[model samples]
Target: TYAETKFIEAEAEFLVANSGSFQATGANAAAYEAYLEGIRANMDKLGVSQADRDAYLSDPNVAVGTANLTMELIMKEKYKALFLNPETFNDLRRYNFDDTIFRGLELPEDHNSVLNGQWIQRAVYPSSEFSRNEDQVRQAEKAIDQPMWFYN
Candidate 1:
């Protein structure tokens, strides 16, 4: 499930990145157009049916003027691509939107939260250190709960 979600997220991010390319000059625009065409071709090869593709392409809500694509549109495509993957949670975390119900007013308080804050950057080293290097393990243990330079 996680893998599926990640795939969707990656696909969405790729589309977002691709659309952003239009902000470039003539040469860049040509290159990005080619890239988008390639993506459409590949999606077809992957068995995404013509009807679905047309649905996405024709959706009025997804239109971005001459751009024809936007982050929200791409994200909708991604959600379809992911289907039933638990990894969508990771995407949610990275986007900092796991709890849309709260609308950013609250966040989960757990080791995962470290990902959104400073502690994650200073995670404890692997417990394997205890078996092969006791002294190093002890030193690391002392620093486990402390913040790193980035946090400061």
Candidate 2:
């Protein structure tokens, strides 16, 4: 979707700026503009009224200037815009689910005890795989709560 692409662009620009990379100066301005453009694109796609969109965008929290913009804000809006999308999980893992970057996200109260309070990092391989290739499956088995190698 156009909105999703803008959100990803916003994050990429933010990362370049925050990391003090070669394009830091331009990236900062680009990040903020892209962030707002993402919101606008999503709202427009949803058919939100212009007045309502203006009101939402004008709010202090949503209108945070470039100097005040943070990855948390960008990710929060992106998460809201893509709540049902699995891509959000990829972003969460990239940040190691840092509470600071994903403010207000909480583990479920009834989460599985096997995790011992840690986030569930990956789904267990299917039982069908174990049944068909027990030896091979065992060799590659990992705890369901173990973070993927890329995430680590």
Candidate 3:
């Protein structure tokens, strides 16, 4: 069981490494490197063999590029790592789909239509419930068509 968990952790680390160059700036690089180090250290603490780490690191199909690594690539790797996880759905919703990568085509002209612009910023409260809680519901509804305060 320990070995299996280690292998999965190693795979996640390999993904972060493969997805980008090491020269990230701002908090992005710091956060990613911290995560990578945590995974690798955990494996070491768990006594995972160097051979296992090498096996994952050496995989040929893993994309490793020093110059072309980017946030987009990291996100793609993250998406793969999150397979079957509930957070994957949230990730999909938050990361606007890049039609070229997701569908192999550009967005249709209708994408710009008012009805298809950005998604509704929030959901409307049920009418019956809103009627019962008039003042509180009205305040909450103010955020429906706009980004939440945190997002703003």
Candidate 4:
């Protein structure tokens, strides 16, 4: 929870600092520091050894720099720290639903039949409900393969 909050704070600070307004963080460096702190909090929570965390952070790909900081890097680390959580799907939606941000994700070969090749957005309405409420279901057009109405 702290890690998530820190990541949000980092992103917010970075955006604010870059916007030319009064820097809420007072300096651009604070944004980068917050990002690193978020990742460190995650690493600590995940039981990564201090030595390993230091090594990983030094790997250039993971350690952030003021010049090198990008939304992609922040989202990638946020995604990693959020592994196995259902909210990750919502993050994908929020971030343009791109699989590239999640480097390891591979869509199942035998995907949901209704989805065909499109990304799944919502679960199918129950078959039992469909029979009892066919008219409502038809009007709702609760397509399993399409995004929810709000997203649309």
- Count of clashes, each model: 4, 0, 0, 0
CA lDDT of each prediction against the hidden true structure:
0.44, 0.83, 0.45, 0.71
Error of 1 at 133 (Å): 14
TM-score of each: 0.37, 0.83, 0.38, 0.67
Distance (Å) between predicted and true CA of 24, model 4? Answer: 21
Q: Quick one: best TM-score, which candidate?
A: 2
Q: List the pairs of residues colliding in candidate 4.
A: none
Model 1 compared with the native: what TM-score? 0.37
Question: Model 2, which residues run further than 4 Å from truth?
Answer: 20-27, 128-140, 149-152
Deviation in angstroms for 40 in model 2?
0.7
* RMSD after Cα superposition, model 3: 8.7
lDDT by residue (tens digit), candidate 4, 1-152 = 88887877777776777673322223367767887888899999989999999999888886647766765676678878888887777766654455554555566899877667777776567899788998998788756666653431
Question: Candidate 3 overall Cα lDDT vs. reference?
Answer: 0.45
TM-score between candidate 4 and the true structure: 0.67
The runs of at least 3 residues in candidate 1 whose Cα sits more than 4 Å from the true structure, single-residue gaps closed, are 1-48, 65-69, 98-152
Q: Give the candidate order by descending lDDT.
A: 2, 4, 3, 1
TM-score of decoy 2: 0.83
lDDT of 1 by residue, 1-152 (tens): 33243434444444455653422222223333443443455467577888886675555653333344333333344555544765444444344342331133354366564355533323466768777898977765644334333210
Better of 2 and 4 by TM-score: 2
Off by over 4 Å in 3: 1-67, 81-114, 126-134, 142-145, 149-152
lDDT of 4 at 46: 88
Instruction: Report the candidate with higher TM-score, 2 versus 3.
Output: 2
